[model samples]
Structures are given as structure tokens and as C-alpha cells.
Target: MAPQGMTEAALTGFRQQLTGDALTSGDPGYDEARAVHNAMIDRRPAVIAQCETEADVARSIRFGRENDLEIAVRGGGHSVAGMSLSDGGIVVDLRRMHTVIINPESRAARVGGGATMSHLDRATQPYDLATTGGRASTTGVGGFTLGGGSGWLERKFGLACDNLLAVELVTADGSTVHASEDENQELFWALHGGGGNFGVATAITLKLHELPAMSMIMLLFRPDSGPEVLRAYRDFVESAPDEVGGGCIYLTGPPEEFVPEDLVGKLVCAVLITYAGTESEARMVAAPMLELAHAAEMIAELPYAELQCMLDDPAGMRNYWSAEYLDALPDKAVDAFCARSSTMIVPSGTQHVLFPLGGAAADGPAHYPLPWRGSPWVVHPFGTWESPADDERGKKWVRDVRADVQPWSNGAVYLNFIGQEGDERVVAGVGGDNYARLAAVKAQYDPDNVFRLNHNIKPA
Candidate 1:
């Protein structure tokens, strides 16, 4: 059914104004159109406008407002909290707008709002150029970059937003605006970590760097070795070069060729070291962990794009994850982090992860709202399972991890790593003062809070 305030004639007129197809309830692809990355979210938007152009985005926003309907924007639909979909509202679906234009000379790429990491990576891989992107290829560049993107290469190239050159956005009033260092300066600053509380981004231009080669080291150890392995990993990463980037995770061993049959389907601790250069350089830098006893290992140089897909979590799984940035990873803390691994759901896709953040990430602009950047390490309890029966257990394990590490927390977090934690967490996500400033910018661009589905910032 159409929203209470919307009539069939109005819906038809709205659909006519779009160059893209609109999917409503009972539409051929409505079910698929409304589905997001998390299977836990099941919402039915009144109209799913698969926008093909910026004009379509503007029209969809206007139609939603005119009909007193909530407006949600869908890009890769990767929000763990399912913020991209609205129940019985209008959805500005930009999947059809996935286009990437690369400029080798300028060393940049103009990515459509709906473009995924795969779209951006594949386009720039041929040129041997790249930028910081989400770990998953299916993640939307716009949402990831705007929410302060963190990925495997963050230590090398910094977060995705750090590479942002400009953004083309359609405001709540159905008008276009361009933000960059030289244009709409305040709004541009907010885009660094403020998320989509301002407007719908049509296109984003990102600065790219030359990436000649990439390599990785994957070593699996017994779950009991987590504390010792993490301690060694911590000591090595403290002085590791900027070219080094990766994470340590405790996950259910996958049935991979490299994984021993005894370890498969069992709780195992793995350490991954991704190097931005050649295999030799990666091996020399990772020599410390190489000497440790291990059950299995894989070391090779691969394409940067290929490395990004290696750890891709399959979609349509139940996911509940949270993170805590730490001032330091002391041995006691490592013990606590490792101990929580026992509580995690086994034989599922869940992972207890630890990512070291420093290098280029810590060296990036300190003025941005990403206060967590300065932290030396971050503990992420990434819970992804296949069964609803495990939902309560999965969510509790994530919360427990956060609680376990509270003693070392820097009191700041990356909003992109969490769901709607709370109003207080939102304040901490973006620094207290930064939140005030972001709200002022929010007031200028979206005073009515038209884009409140995300970690919302009320207009000042």
C-alpha cells in the first residue's frame, strides 16, 4: 500500500518524473530491491526509485517530502544497522548510478554515489592506481568514505575520506551543491566523518596513489596461542612501516586448501599482514611472526584488488559488530581480548578482530572529526553468523568485547564500525566539539533533518 498521505495518482506522477524504474509493493523486484546486506533487516519502502541521475535523486527527495513520507537512500545497502532502507517510505536507490570515471593523468577517480568498492577498484587497478577502500568489495564508496572509511590499506593511504577531492550532493530541497576544500568548506569538513545526515551524494572524486604491487601473509595458530600471538603482533606493528597494513582475527577456520583438516570448522587464531609493495618486502617485514609455530600459512604477492576480496564476508548473513579504539594494547588487555574469543559463537562466520591503526592514518589531518585515528590499536568484535538462533548470543558477544576493553578505550569510536549505539556514543564518535560544529553545518544544509536515518546529528 502507498503511504497514508500518498495517493496512487501522486505516486504515478512521481514515478513519471524519474528516468529510472520505481519499485513499489508487489512490484516485480520489490523484495530484492528492499533487501540490504544484513538479513536481519526486513523493511518495505513504499517506492524504491532506482535513480539513474542526480535529477532523479532530487525528484525522489522532493516527492517524499511532499507526500509526508520518510526518505531513505540506498547505495551498496551495506549499513549494518540497515539505515539505507525505510519502512513504508520512499527510497532513493542509486544502484543504477554505479559508474566510475578514472583520470590517470590527474591521479583521481570520479565515482558515482552508488558505486561499490569493486567498481572503484576494478576501474583503477588497470592504471596501477588506488586509494583507501573498505575491506569488502561490495561496500558502497560514498557511504564508506563519508563515514570515515577504514580498510586494509588505511595505514598506507589513510582512510578513504582522506583521499576525497570533491563531492556532488543533492540537498533536501532538491538542489545540487558541490563541496571541496575550496567550495562549501564547512560542509566538506563535515563530510569527512559526519556520514549522510546532510544530503544525498551524487558523485565523489577521490585522489589516488600509485600502487605498483601488493602482498600478504596469512598464518593460522591454535586458539590458545591468541594471547602470545597478539603480544608479538603488537610489538611488531608498533614499529612496522607505513606500507604494512592488516589485522589479527580469531575466526572459525574455513575449509580452505591452506587450512589443515584438523583446524577446519574449529576456533582458530589468524594473523594477516598486508604489504603495499612486493612479496620480498612483505616477508622481510613480517619475519617476526614467520618464526612462530603455526598450523598453516600462505604467503604471496597479489593484486591490490584481489587482496581486498580475500576476506570478503558473504552477504545476507546476520551481522552484529562493535569496536573500541585503545590507547595501548597491554599484555593484560591482550589476555582479556583473547579470553572473550571463547564466548563467540563457533562454527559460524563470526570473528574477534584486532586492527592496528597508526602510520598514515594517525598522520592524516587531525582537524577532521575522526578522533579515533590517533589510537594505536582498535578491537573490533565482528559478528557474522547464518542463523537467527544465534542472534542473541552473537550480539551479547560483541557487547562483552566492548565492555572488556573499556579500561583501555580512548573514549572515541569510528561511527562506521557500529550501529546506532546511542546519542552519547554519537557525540564520542565525532568529538564533542566537532559534533557541535557538524550540527551547525547540518543546520545550514538540512535544518529539517531530512536525512536522519544515519547516526543523526540534530541541526544546531
Candidate 2:
């Protein structure tokens, strides 16, 4: 049993059913098993069952149901809210099933649910094949794709959800089914951008593309020039072609080894660039950004995966994120963001981004269950802190950033970035119409809502 307490007999019975590692709260690995990527979270689940195969996932699901225990499925455990654990329940951890099968001839890869972006990238990079994945190297492909992954290649290709070819799911009844275009097409549709409400996906097949050589540019401008900088960014996004994908980080200077110590905690604006063309083209593409104002330039040509790691935050940092999809980045909105951004506290820990999402993401008439499509840009306010005492400060910063963008936003957010707000935010993630349809599908496949923990979609 867990810290809250369960009987030894019940725990032994559960262990008997598990072929993979079964860690209880009393075990030596207990504290580490309960720890998620976000240090802010600390929950004690009764069972931390790491599944080795699809059968293990199925058995765990049934076991949790039979025992009347709440279930939390964890992929990368990178969630800011730490929704992958309950007070005293079963946690079906998918970390042990890290496998990526790449078929270069077909330009597709079948990945285990536990595989991280780094795992998939390492497996596919040798062939120069890539897919729509998260920006961070360690983010879980499962949670990111399930919530409609948006990233550096989104405008060139599409949402990660759109690239899904098929998935192996363990339904509420413990039956395993393959979902794709022909077999269970309805289930396939729900999987794209539906969050993790439908079922537990043991494996996913994704379509990959030949990645062209890319050059990224990193520029930092003064805080006073934030408004002009953001305005220029908006113009660049509006006029730039699909080949260019990048965003700006509004934060203070970080005390990296290369940066001077005095500039470490000062408010600054950072603009990052990643393009789908050659270095020559990236230079021309980055010219306008240079003209914005006086600042520092740390841009260069690098491997696609290398560029992804350049922005990685320090490990063990507490953070919260909120997002809004914009139809257009208005001048006033740009000014508003710049105004508050200059005053951002905690300097190096705060992050603000404007994700480019158009060309490919909006070009398709794809039948994804999620309502969001055709959005011009996605804005995320990523708040982070190294100290535990800064918890409320970080939370308030995220909340305020979200509030500032409300006027220009369309309300629907990227579910992957959302925290444990409430059902209202869940309904807001997928619009009312889409939520209803998802609910109906959920009722048909999972009437009891065994998988209701994630941006939960209750049965209709």
C-alpha cells in the first residue's frame, strides 16, 4: 500500500499480478518513484506500476478498477500540475516501455508511450527523419501528441496530433484495440487532440519527414524596446513564409557562464529563430529582427536536435504554464505584452513565448476531435522558480500573464500546457461543441471514465 496506507496482503496481491517493477511507498525507491519532473509536486500513490508491455498496462487498468482505486498514467512525468498521481491510488507509470521502431523506407516510426522526444530524435535523426514533437528534449511524446503537440516544425508540417498514423489502446474494459484509418476510425479521430480521456495508448505510430538543414538565430534586445521588438516579431510572422519558425522569450538575463554576472537578473527580450532552409536563407530571414533595436546576438547554425536543447531550463525547477491561441497579434496586444514583460520578476526564471502556428497547421481540413485549428499564433507564459518559497510568486505571474492575453485570445488553450484548473478550463480547452462530441465518443468507448484524470472528459 501507499503512505496513506493499504494492507500488506492487498499490496502482495497486486505485486503478484505485476510482472514489471512494482514500487510501493515503503520501498527504497519510493521517494524517487513519486517524484515528477516538476519539483513542486509531491504525491504518495499506493502503487507505482511501471508497465513493460501492453498486457501489463491492461492488467494494471483492471486491477485499479477492481480495487476501486484512482488511476494516473504517466508518460514523461513533466506535467507542471503533476496530474499523474493521486493521494492513495494506482499510478500506471509507462517509463519502462521506451522503444522506438523506425522504418526509414516508410518514413514512419512506432514509438512506445514512454519514449521521450530525445529518444525518438536519437532513433530517427540518423536517417534525417523527424516528426512534429515538443520543443523540449525530455518531454514525453505521448502526453505532447495526445494534447496536440505544437513545436518548431508545426508551421512546416502540422500539429503532432495530425501526424499520428495509429495507436494501440487499452480501453476501460481491458481490451486492446488498434486504432487507425480503417480499424476504429472514430477512435482514431478522437485520439488526435483528444487528450488522454479516451484510453491508455500503449504505443503510437507517427509519420516522419526528411528534415532539411536549419539555422537558428538568438537575439536579445533591451527591455525598453520590447514593444518595438514584439511588433516587429508580429510583422515577421505575418509576412514570413512557412519555412521560418521561431519565437521570442521575454525574460531577464540568465547568469550563464558566457553571460556577464551583472546582467544575470535583468529583464530582457530574447528572440529565437529556426528555419527550414539553408543558413543563407536564415540570414535574410533574420535581418528584420536585427533592425528592431540594439541588443545581443547568439544565433548560429546547428543540428535540429541541438537547437531544441539550447533552450532547456534547469532541472528541478518549479513552473506553471498557460496559453492562448491568437487569430491575429494586434498592435495593442503586442504593446500590452511588452509593457508587463519589462516588469517581470524572478529575472532568469520567467519565460514568455509566442508560438508560430499557421502554414501547415492551418492548411489542413483534418478531422481532429479538438476544436482548435486555423489559429495564427499560440502564446504561452512559462513561469519557473528554483526556490520553493517562490511558489506563489510564480503561480501569480502565470495567472497574470494569462489574464493579460485574455482580450486578444480565443479562449481555447493547448491542453498539454494546462494545469489542474477545473472542468471549466477543460471545456475551454476543447470548445463546447467538440467537448460534446468527445463526450459521446467517450461514453461509447469508456462510459465509466476509467481514464478521466487528464483534462478529463466525462461520459456524456
Candidate that scores best on TM-score: 1
Name the regions of candidate 2 deviating beyond 4 angstroms: 1-7, 256-262
Indicate the worst ten consecutive residues by lDDT in candidate 1: 1-10
Regions of candidate 1 where Cα sits further than 4 Å from its true position: 1-3
TM-score for predicted model 1 compared with the true structure: 0.99
Candidate 1 Cα deviation (angstroms), residue 448: 0.4
Clashing pairs in 2: none
Residue-level error in angstroms, candidate 2, position 158? 0.4
Give per-residue CA lDDT, model 1, range 1-460, as digits (tens).
4556678888888878889988888889899889898899999888889999999999999988998889999899888999999998889999989999999999999999999999999999999999999988999999999999999889999999999999999999999999999999999999999999989999999999999999999999999999999999999999899999988999999999999999999999999999999999999999999999989999999988898888888878999888999999989899999999999998988989999999999999999999899999999999999999999999999999999999999989999999989999999999998989999999999999999999999999
Candidate 2, 1-460: lDDT as tens digits: 4334456676677677777877876788878888887888888888888889888898889878877889999998888888888778898999888899999999999999999898898888788888878888888999899888888888888888888999998888889889998899877877877878888888999999998676887787777777888888888888888878889778768766644555568877888888876788888977888676555676566677777766777777787888877767888788767766754565556788777778988886455655556778777888887887877777887778778878878877778877888898888777777788889889988999888778888999
Pairs that clash in candidate 1 = none
